[model samples]
Target chain A: MRLPPILVYVLRRLAIGLVVLFGISAVAFSMAYLLPSDPVTSRYPDITNEQRAEMRRQMGLDQPLVVQYARYMESVFRGEFGRSFGTGNSVVQDLAQRIPATLELASFGIAFGVLVGIPLGLVAAVRRGKPTDHLVRVVNIAIQSVPAFWLGVVLIFLLYFQWRLVPSPIGRLSPMFISPPPVTGFLTIDALLAGKPDIAFAALRQLMLPALVLGLGVVSPLARITRSAMGESLGEDYVTFGRALGLRPRQVVLGDAFRGALVPIVTTLGFVVANVLAGAAIVETVFAWPGIGRYAVTAITTSDMAPVSTCILLIASSVAVTNLIVDLSYALIDPRIRHEYAR
Target chain B: MGEKLFEIQNLSIDTRRGGVTRRIVENMNLAVERGQIYGLVGESGSGKSISMMASVGLAAPGLLVRSGEVGFGGRRLPASDQKGLRGNLSHGVSLLFQNAKGALSPFLTTGRQVERVLAQRKVPKPARPKEITELFRLVGLNFADLGEKYPHQISGGQAQRVAMACAMASNPALLIADEPTTALDVTTERELLRFLTRICRERDMAIVLIAHNLSLVSEYCSGLSIMHAGQVVEEGALRSIFATPLHPYTKGLIAAVPDVDEPHELVPLEGSVWGGRNDIVRCRFSHRCPHVRARCEAGLPPAIARGGHQVHCVLYEGEAA
Candidate 1:
């Protein structure tokens, strides 16, 4: 039996995504190899040539560039990211241990941005020239221009130091609390599974300020895109037709207009997700949170080639996968494209 | 003719931009009885579509009904009462626009689109499918072949028929068709107009047909309103308006229409539409009127009654019936 067209399309995308990821990893590996500060020199500034050669050989650096890259690819295939020069732990294992905290932050940040951005955008578009629209526009522009690190610091100062409204911004958990058992590699979900409401609440409270800052960073672009998309959709003939059919104003705005506006909004959301992840890396540093972002930052600062390459490779693959999902959603969001895909 | 089903009296519409308001459609009086096709004819920006839209409470954004009273089913409709108008829409008022393909959602199939209207009309769950099929059939579409196709998949004319089917889903009493055939070829235009007239007859439905082409209006309309520069120039029974072209603007419009039997040089109207901000109280078409007089600019000409017809021109003020 013939498989469905959508399945075939998704499979083709997956194959392309893999090849792109492979290309990205290759570029990342080469870039990391070319860095002036390698593990040997950074670890021992006054090291002799004999000691340097031995360290290089152990890390497979003495081999040819192609051989090193092939070995790196082989190790990556075996779910190993080599080892961090400082800690001597598998980079993959280090990332796996810390990913839950980052995932927890970025997910909440993006969800907050979208959940709040869409409604604010709809209001702005629906009342295009009104005071509310002007206010939302000004606020969004402010958010868009403000850097993530500055916003995170400001939020921490205002909410923590000045207002004393929030708990200290140290890491994912409070000093009094212990982390919940891991399940599905998401801290919040793991906490809920571990059935420790107090621990979960504490983790969430610790996440709030950094996530809000990161989320605020993305909200502006999402809201701007949504506003324009909805404004255009609202001007469409079908929206007027819906109104003429005597459907309620709510129905016309939300049902007909929103559905038409969704394609562009979905496309924006995919990019927003990727941007939030990148923003989280900076946010994680500001808050001193133990996530892959800080882990990668430490590796880069110490000239650890393997961990840095692995981090770049991971980020690029995740972004590529997000874009694939976005491309697939276009078919689902619009029947015209879906029909074209079938053809 | 059936009793009057709807009327718009002294309708005035305006557009507000940057704290400035300007009148676009002024003192528009129109009446359409059940089963009658009332043609509102004018050039673009004459506010023909705006007037009809305001009548049905679907004015485009930024255009406001400054003053008007819409009467439907023997109840007076205040211009400000939009919620009441929306409520009355299901008491059967529907609209069809010129761009039929654009009027249907591209995201939904044609059949599903029709079903959306039916669902809005509150048709019972079990009966909606049957009703959708029946409506598609009524509008001359085969549900099996064309129903599942998106608006872009079908031909323009077919898409229009789908729009017509969606309009019929509500079984409306007053159908406001705004240049419904402007996008179609000559043959499709005629077929669609004929289909519209047939529906008007079969359902005893009153239709406000807003169009620019004089020939199409003359062919299909029983009653006609000729508009110029946002004001009514002449109006009455179509035969009487055609016979006695009193307004100079009306005469120029008729003269511009190409007549195969009496072929002559097509006289395009001399001047473009009046759009400047001046002479708030004067006749708008005075600049374009062939028989313009000093009195024409002093004030707008009042409608002069003559044998079941009315013409807004100073020349016709004292003419004998």
Candidate 2:
């Protein structure tokens, strides 16, 4: 009996992802361990050297490097990422509270980028060498070159400071409204599920600028990739064949050329998503958003090694998951690629 | 000869490259009669494919039809009327381009591709599946094994057959095949050509066979026009033209074809076709003609009629024999 090839491919990818996660965690932990600033000293600056040694013994940091690595792996296996010395909370617990905010921001950013970018690319490709094509390229380049942090600030100044078109970007919600109970930990969804449109709207309003800035930063590559791919696909003999068959221009471009152009776009989407997720840190810090990226910054600034390493591991895992999904979806969308999975 | 079904007269195509406009095809004429295989043979850049593309409105990007008139199904078609061309040609004319594998949408199954064209042509929903299966069979392919296969899954011959099936799905009256067998093996090419000939005879459909292979065209086509540098150098019945070749360029083309029965050294034609000479008033083929004369470069030569044949050359000034 033979197993389905797709399942085999998925399993192979899962095994590789697990290995990658393990490697990331080990390297992060090793780097943090070798850092000059000890976690005990950072947490308890006023304590004597004797007390510090006692604290190190209790925390098992006084052990050999191999033993410490084994102990760290044991804790990680148990879903424990140790405790943040600065905040005195479990790193996993802090991550659980903050990961949703990062996910929401990144998701919106990428969704906005893709939604706007693909259509613009199609238009640019079809109107190649025309004024519309030139306009789209210039806009795409401008959006890509503008730094997200700067864009966030400018947007804040115009929308919030000058025109007063939006609410203050104090955080996810105003002080007047308390957050809804965490269900999926995503504020907008949780608020909607809790039947509070006001809360959801406020959270969304606060999310708009940062996501927009990050999304616009990504739009250039998406649009450029889409345009080039579409242009090349349009030149393909199949497209000519489609047109010769007397199929409408709409069908030829959207149905045949678009699908042919999608493989490259989809491959690019994975990198874009990963970049968005990783890039959320700077945007979060600039906007004072309560996300894992902001939390990671705080941990790094305060020299909290556990939380920083934990954040690294989590991000690596997410990237791995994204790549797997992209790879699997590639097979699903294009049958030509699906055959490669057959074993 | 069958009734005249399609024609392209005074067809001139221009293309712009690096800010300079140039004529790629000029004052070309072709007429395809019903049930007749009309071969348009020329070397690579001689407008054989471009002329057919212009008739079907599938000319390569950036090519403009400067002046031409296409006649299809007794109706006159204005140049640049793409909408009219597409609508009129959809039912009557279908093209089979070179590189059968590339001609197919790689993502679609061969059956699905045929079904798409059938559906677009408004074949009844209930009959499409059966009709598609029958078409596959008509092209000597199995519906079950090959229908679900993508373009790359099939062999080159099978792919060409699949293309033929798709072309026939609309029951087109005219099939413009542009070097359809160039990419296949010799055996496969022969097989595909035989299939094309059978379809032409059985369905009474006119075909414009565009190819550089003179021998292949000689075997299949009844009437043909020889093109060089965007102009038709000779036009006539294939048998008559082969017997009494008039134009020097035409003679060179025949001499280049290798013969197994009476082996002779292949005499390759000297000089290359000038691609972008739109301003030249002389004959386009004069530079490459062995019988080049001072008068050949002075002005364009008129077509000298020889019975049912015609040759455009200064050497055939007033000879009627």
Candidate 3:
């Protein structure tokens, strides 16, 4: 038996989507390569001839350019994401250690953003001229324009310096005691499992500035988009159909309004993730967080192209995967847009 | 009080434009009796759709109701308050949008979508299973396997039936079909309406069938209201309106339809409906009303009722002139 037309379209799109992603990765990778500075030379000033030769052999850098490229692709396909030249550790291991933190931050930030922003946006749309709407708009504008780095710095200065409310950013954990073997690899989760409130609090304190900075930056744009989308959806013909059916305001908003709102929200997620990744690099360095972004910057400064490649792939894959998920969800959120293909 | 199942009394809609208010639909009134199909016929932007949407309190953002009292089931419609209206009207009233494909939720299965309507209205637990099966059967759909299918799996006609089934889920007192068959092919349109007529007859459902097609309503509607520029230019029994269209716009619309028996030349209405962001002292149709007189532009015309037919035109001011 054959699958449906929409399913076929979805599969075709997935195939096409993969090709498009590959092309995007190629362009981004090429640009990264073209940028000035290599990480190896910046880190190691005095390298003996033997050390240089050993490093070359270890990196497979002495091989022809085509040979190196082929090997990189081969390893990438098998999930052996090369080694970090700066720390001389497996890139996979580094990723395994850092991914959970970045993801936790990004996911939490999005959840927080959507939870807060959607309501604010709805308020802005419903009460367009009222003081509440104006205040939200003003706040959104402020949040949108302020740089995440600057915002993070200010939050730390005020919340950390004056109040001494949050725990110090001691790299995903506290300095007061020893920790377990980092099961789950998320400090908060690990802290909970170990029943150590100190570690959990430390983890939360470290997480606060990053999550706030990331979530804050996203809240404005997300809220604005959600508001406008809700407004637009509320005006759609079907919403009238809903009202004519005598649906409640809450019903109209959730069933009718929210359905229409997803198109923008899904599209916005792509931009949000891009912003988060970019911010991740800067934020990681700022907080001295031992994440991939921090490692990537260090690897780049030392011209460790292998680890840099891994980082590039990680970010690229993340963006591609997120975009794909959002695309798939479009058909789910709105029943009107029937997919030509889905698997 | 009991003559008509629904009555729109002096309905008017106002829209804000550039900080100025202008009337869109003014003092429009119509009656839809139980077991009667009332067709609302008009060209695009003639306020036909807006009138019905507004009458049911479905006016979207930016469009405000200047004045109106829509009464159904002995209670004045709470158009101004959406919260107050939901419980009373929602389960009792269902609207079929123009685009069948666009109207139904794309994500949900046809059965599930129909089930949601049943669920939201909180259909009694015992009656639900039996009712679901009966509804599917009535709409010419078999739930044996097809009910599991999504909107994409079905044809346009089937999707419409599914939508109809959804609208009929709670066994509504009124079924408001806004161009239900416009998206369907002729054969399918005919088939769907036949099914609709059958169901209405069996269920005693009052239908407010809105459409641009005058002939379509002529065939189905027992009564009809003709709208032009947000006003009911003419309204009466379908047969009466067809026999002698009181309004010039109605006359033009009837004239435009191709008749096999008459075999007459088609005369399309000359201009489009008026669209501007300005106030009007005179009649809106005056800009396009072929029977326009100098005095017709002086003030807003009243809906002159004679022998149960109302035509908002200066020519009808005299008794049966």
Give the least accurate 10-residue stretch of model 2 chain A, judged by summed lDDT: A334-343
The CA lDDT of each predicted structure is 0.86, 0.87, 0.76
What TM-score goes with each of the models? 0.95, 0.95, 0.85
What's the lDDT for candidate 1? Answer: 0.86
Residues B147-187, model 1: lDDT tens digits: 88999999989988998998888899989999999999999
How do the residues A121-231 of candidate 3 rate in per-residue lDDT, one tens digit apiece? 989887877899999999988888898778777877788788888766656666676665577777777888998877777677778778777788678878889889988
- Show model 2 residue runs off by greater than 4 Å: B258-266, B275-277
Give the candidates in order of DockQ, highest first: 1, 2, 3
lDDT of 3 by residue, B1-321 (tens): 236788888887888868888788877888888878889988888888777777666676688877767787778764565344444556577788878766666556877777767777788777777787788999998977668887777888888888888888867888888889988899999999999998999999989998988878888888888887777888887777788777788888888999988899999888788775446667777788788999887655676776556677788787664
Query: What's the C-alpha lDDT at position A7 in model 1?
Result: 89
Candidate 3 overall lDDT versus native = 0.76
Scored by lDDT, the top model is 2
Q: What DockQ does candidate 1 score?
A: 0.73
Chain A TM-scores, candidates in order: 0.96, 0.95, 0.87
Model 2 lDDT per residue over A95-173, tens place: 8788888888888888889999999999999999899999998998888778888888898999999999888888678
